[model samples]
Target chain A: MSAIEVSGLRKAYGGVTAVDGVDLDVAAGEVFALLGPNGAGKSTTVEVLEGHRKRDSGEVRVLGRDPGKPSGDWRARIGVVLQATSDAAELTVREAVAHFAGYYPNPRDADAVIDLVGLTEKAGARAGKLSGGQRRRLDVALGIVGRPELLFLDEPTTGFDPEARRQFWRLIRLLADEGTTILLTTHYLDEAEALADRVAVIARGRIVAEGTPSTLGGRATAEATVRWRGADGPQVRRTPDPQRLIVELARHEELAELTVSRPTLEDVYLDLIGERA
Target chain B: MSTMAVGAARGRLELREFFRRKDAVVFTFALPAFLLVLLGSVFSGTVLGDMSMSQLFTASMVGAGIISTSFITLGVGVAGDREDGTLKRLRGTPMPVAAYFLGKLALVAVASVAEVALLLAVGIGLYGVELPADPARWLTFAWVFGLGVVSCALLGIAASAAAKSARSAPAVMNLPYIGLQFISGVFINPIVVLPSAMVAVASFFPLKWIAQGMRSVFLPDEAAVLEMAGTWEHGMTALVLGAWCVVGLGLCLVTFRWTDE
Candidate 1:
């Protein structure tokens, strides 16, 4: 069974439509990324799936139960890592994790989850006293201590440094390896590319594109740019086949600083979102 | 885990949270003890009608402690947590909201115990206030203390629900907190000193009842003549406090939002 399914989902806050006629599906054990710019309804959509927000209209199922009216058991099966660090500032890292662990039916060991988040050394430190990156790791520790079947990470790496970002990616990969389905929302393109099995881009409350990262918006099949220094000082050409162009150029016996390039996933993503405007 | 276990775990963690903060521990638990000392020493040989000044001051301060600590502290604490996203994180869990409240309530109860104990010990040690002679009066103290905590804590929850931001939390809590203090005789004995309007207003809240009820328990029975009604009015005290608990809790449950509106 799919980990999640949504059809014709709609939500509005006052008169402003946040999520409009959206549909989505995630197969079991799949790692899906929801990518969008600010105010693109990414959070509103995710909140609905987590049963934190009510939808105006939709057929939504998470683990075969309606998220609109989630039972306690349904909540137990899902974990959520919010955009901000949890407000457990006064407690030690171990205490915060242990406290949340008690909320689930079969919780993961608190110490183990702490070690998994690379926070073992800071386990005794107050959660509020931790650095920004360290506190985010604590958030992940609390998120996973419940041993949830599905985890939702909303902008999970927003405040992380480059090193911290890489470390967090490893933790996410570890969770996925343990067969925990993941639905992540992020603004960083590289983050989505590195961890997402599939990604969807949303703009102004509507999805603009959805596919594998490598081929999203036909990025893989898109025209490539071939460039080299020639008699004209420089030359550039666009073609669907860079290999053939390179082969033809190679016959000249020399090509100065020759290079072939394709539009990156980011490039294609921007164009897709721009197309709507 | 069972719901009770979750509540206990959260409660334990919250207790640590309560003590770890120098400000929360000092302001919520230590302030009343400090007030008892300062006031008791100043009015060393004075008397308010039939009661010694120390006895009256100690009784009134107990009501003030319940309001300042349980009502003001928890009011700001709850508002700050909601503003900063702590409560929202708990909302995502299977842990019932009631369990979170149980943790908060437990913390308030413990703080109230510490506050009362400190004030009583200091009043008896420094001044010459006497403990209740009758064992049954202790029972009245217990129930009145319990009910006072409930009434004040619920008021805290309701205030937090109304607070729009952490910055506004203090004003949200202190408005009613300070208002109730003056009318309820926390800073001074209001038995004969309170204007009729103040008496009428304070009658609706639990703080005045708490002070009067505690005075009946801690002071000699003959001291009851100093009260406006010349009696302990135990029934009215229970009724008013119980009603506040019911109404305050109802208001909180109905209006409390896990996320900022």
Candidate 2:
């Protein structure tokens, strides 16, 4: 069953439409990525789904219940890590996590969540005293402390270094492996390609493309580029099938340092965002 | 997710934060005491020609409590929450947004009671201000004090919606408070110095009613000779203050946001 289903979702600020006729379906235990540029209605759509904003028109069902009219129990079943951390600067990390955990019926242990987020050493430290990356991890810890079935991650790693980003990906993968459905929105295409099982690209309040990382925009099956070093120097060819071209060149006994490659997810994403804009 | 539990959790969170903030505690408790001592001592010797110094000090001290709890403390706390996006984060949780206000009011009520107690002790010990001899007057004082705090706290919440930052919150809460203090006969008798328009405006605000209620307790019935009313007029002040409390709470309900802008 789909963990989240949104259809015909619409929202407007004054006369301008923020989320216009948007639709999405995310299956349970699947990692779904929503990719878009700024002002593309990505955050608006997510906010509506999270029940933080009222929708002008449309149906949004999370866990088969309307998100707009969610019961407290329904809310307890979902986790959200917002773009910013909580503002309780005086609270210690352990106190903050424990406080949030008490609201859920079947919450994970607070210490376990803190450990999962790699904040065990900073558990006694005040939230305001922590570094930005540490605070982001605390935000994640609070979100998952509820032991929710579905999770919303909004720009989860915007301020992290390369190593921290990689570590966060592992944590996300671990959550997904535990059968939690994840809906991710991010600007980093490499992160999406690395973590998402399937991705949907949104542009100007609409989905421009949707597919797996390798097959999106026919990236897997499109014409491949073949490159090699000949006696003359580097040579290149765009071909319908690079395998055939490489075999032909090999038959001539002249191809060296041969390589064949297809378009990456970023190439497809840029084209999609560019064309729609 | 339970409303009761969430309310309790919010209250606990507020208490924890309040105790954690040493600076906030210092201001919340010590500032009122310091002001009461300084003002009470400076004004203790002079009868100001006609008015007794203790009487005037008592009324003004009551005003100080209302302004401090309602405006200074509430304004800074709520505006700070808005600026830090704490209110916004709470909106995303299962905890009802109204619980935040409830928790804040609860904290303010307890702390304000402590503040009032501290001032009352000073009033008796140093200023020779007599406590009400009648138990009924003390009962009225208790009810009036509680309701007055409610009205002011609600007003503070309303004022904070317009405040841009924590630094500006004090000014937002104090602008009307300072004006109301004089018109309510806190620092000076209203019948002597206030204009009719000022009296009308003061009657509408909570400070005047709080002073009237406190005067009813502290002053002897014979002291009525000093003012036109000659005795505490409890009915009108209670009615107006009650109305303010109800309306202020309504405004808070209608305009309050867990996260706005």
Candidate 3:
């Protein structure tokens, strides 16, 4: 069975519709990324799937049961790292992670989870004293300590430094390697490209496109842009056959600074976000 | 973890957090002790019926202490936690939301007990406060203290719904509490001597009942003449507090919010 299946999900607030209509399916053990700009209803959609918000109408089956009527056993199998900062400010990192671990049936060792998040050195420090990036790491630790079969990370690396972000990416890869299904929402296109096996770009409360990161928006095999310095000075051409164009250029003249480029994931994402905005 | 185990862990966390802030600890325990000593010393020369003012005021502080330590403390603490997203975080966990409140209650209960102990030690050691020789008086103190703590804890949970943020929690809890103290005669002498309208209004809340119950324990029978209708109204105290308990629990069930929404 799919890890998550949502059909025509709809939610609104008074006069404003947040999630107008949405459908998603994540296969078991797949790493899925939800990409969207601010106000695209990504948070609202995730909250509904997490059983933290009530949807107006739709069918959502997560781990073979409706999240709307979540039980303790069901919650034990899923872990959530929210956008909001963890507020166990008085607790040390180890204490905070240990406390959350007790909520699950089979939890990972708190110390190991702390080390996984690269917080072993600061494990004894109070949560309130940690820097923003360190606190984000601690949040991830608490979320994964439950040994969840499926983990939900909602904009998990908002405040991370470059090194911390790379470390976090590695940790997520390790979890996914162990066959843990992960559903992540992030704004960074590179982060999505580096981790997501499948990516969905949402705009204005709806999914604009969904596919593998490399092929999203037909970028994988789309017409390439060929550029080179020529006798005329400089030249640019868009063609489906970039290799033939390069060969033609070489026969005509010695190519200088020749290059072929394809549109990046960020280029497609911006177009998607802008088209709906 | 089992529900009981979760409650224990949360309770320990709550107590540790409560003490880590020196101001909350001072306000929770020291405020009552300070007030008890101040009132006992100020009224040492006065007597209500056969009971010295020090002894009589000691009983009133015990009632006030229960409300302050348990009811007000929970109201403010729950409101603060709700405002700061702490409760929202816990709601997502497998730990039952009810267990969070259970832990809060446990914290308040322990604080209330310690608060009473502090007040009693101050009263007996310093003021030489009167203590009834009858074992029944201690029994009355025990049950009354229990009922008072529970009823206030419930009401406090309900009252937290009105607090919009952490900054407003103290105001939310204190406004009604200060008013109740006056109406319940915590600051007044000759409680029965108050106008009938005031006494009637005070009867609607648990503070007056708690005060009356505590008074029944510390005072000799002759002092009953100084109370409303020239009697201790022991049965009425239980019935009234019991009714408040039911109403407080109802309000809590209806108004408790895991998030600030």
Candidate 4:
């Protein structure tokens, strides 16, 4: 069964349309990345899905229940890591995780979840005292401590350092391996490429492109750029058939350490967002 | 978990936050103690024509404790939570918003008890204050304080909901607090020096009757001769305070936003 199904979703704040007729379906255990620029209605759509904001018009189902009118049991099945931390400054990491765990029916052991996030050492420290990276990890721990079937990570690594970001990606991979469906939103294209199995890019409140990272905007089968060291120091050519180019170069006797590469996920992302302008 | 357990947990957390800050702890208990001492010392031997200074001191000290815990502490704390995004986060949780408020009121109740104990210690040891020497009077003191705490705490929450930021919290709390002090006869004897507008305003709020109720509990039997509404009328005072509690709670429920709008 699909973990989340959002169709014909439309929302607005006064005169500005935040989400416009969006449709999405995320299957169980899939790490789906929602890629979008700022003001593309990504956060608003997430809020509506969390049952925190009312949508003007939509048919959204999360865990087989409408998020707009989620029962308490439905909330327990889904974990949400919002853009900001919970307002529990005085609570220790262990205490905060334990306290929130009480709200769920089948909560993961708080200590285990804390260890998963690499915050077991800082479990006794007050939330307000944690560093930016540690706090973001704590936020993740709190969100997943419920052992949710579907988890929403909204810019989860915004303030993380490179090492911390890599560690977070590993934790996400572990969750996905454990059969947890993840809906991740990130501005970092590299993060999307590394962790997301599929990505949907939105621009101006609409999904302009959706596919796997390799094939996003036909990047996998797109023209390949072949570069080699020639008599003039270097040589390069863009060809639709890299194999033919390599064969033609081989017929000339010495291919001379040729290299073939295609457009990266970052390049495709830029092109997709650029076309909107 | 039952709602009651949730409320208790919230109360415990709030109490922990309440004690963590040295400044908050000092202000919560110290200012009232200092004011009581200063007033008790300066007016110890003086007589306001017919009434002794001790009688006036006891009445005013009780009023101070009620106002401080209910209005000053509660108003500032709620506004601070709103500013810090604590209230918004709690709203998102399954933990009922009422639990947060119940926790706050529970803290106010506990603080009121401690405040009364401190006032009684100072009243008996330092100022030679008497406690009416009657069983019924003691009972009246308990009921009056209970009613007063409930009324003041709800009103404090109502006031805090209007406050936009923590910086503006004190400004928002002080005016109504001070106004109640003057009108409710917390500083001076209201009977002899009556300001018509102040009297009208005080009569409308629960603080004035709360003070009046305390005076009835401590003062001599003949003191009822000068009573405006009811002589030793615990019923009337309770009714007035109950009314304030209902109205104030309704206002809090109606307009209080867990987030900044």
Per model, kept true contacts as a fraction are 0.86, 0.51, 0.47, 0.22
| Pairs that collide, model 3 | none
Q: Considering every candidate listed, which one attains the maximal DockQ?
A: 1
lDDT of 3 by residue, A108-162 (tens): 9999999988899999999989988888888778778888889999998886788
Q: Write the per-residue lDDT of candidate 4 for residues A1-277, one digit (tens) a residue.
A: 8988999999988999989989998888899999988999998888888778889997998888888886667777888887765466778999888887776678899999999999999999988899888888888887888788898899989978899889989999999999999999999999999999999998788887899988999998999999998766788999999998888887765667789999988788778788433
Worst-scoring 10-residue span by lDDT in model 2 chain B: B222-231
Instruction: Write model 3 residue lDDT over B154-222, tens digit each, in one string.
Output: 999899998888788888888888888877867775587688899899998999989888888876777
Instruction: Grade the docking of candidate 3.
Output: medium
**lDDT of each candidate versus the true structure:** 0.86, 0.80, 0.86, 0.80
Highest TM-score among the candidates is held by which one?
1
Task: List residue ranges in candidate 2 displaced over 4 A.
Answer: A227-234, A247-260, A275-277, B26-29, B48-55, B121-134, B164-168, B187-197, B219-228
For model 1, how does the per-residue alpha-carbon lDDT over A1-277 read when each residue is reduced to its tens digit? 8999988889999999998888889988989999888888999999999999999998999989999897888888999999885587888899888878888889999999999999999999988899988998898888888889999999988878999999999999999999999999998999999999999998888888899999898888989999999866889999999899889888875789888888988788788778434
Answer with 2 or 3, whichever has the higher DockQ.
Answer: 3
Off by over 4 Å in 4: A227-236, A246-261, A275-277, B48-55, B130-133, B189-191, B218-236
* Per-model DockQ against the true two-chain complex: 0.78, 0.51, 0.55, 0.40
Error at B69, model 4, angstroms: 2.5
Pick the winner on lDDT between candidates 3 and 4: 3
lDDT of 2 at B61: 75
Q: Could you tell me how far off, in angstroms, the CA of residue B118 lies in candidate 3 after the best superposition?
A: 1.8
The stretch of ten residues in a row with the least summed lDDT in candidate 1 chain A is A268-277
lDDT of 1 by residue, B1-261 (tens): 666777777777778888888878886678788878887777756554555687888878876787676888789889888988888898888998778888888888877887888888887887777787788999999889888889889889888988889889888777887687777777666466788788888888888899888887888777787777889999999999999999988989898878786
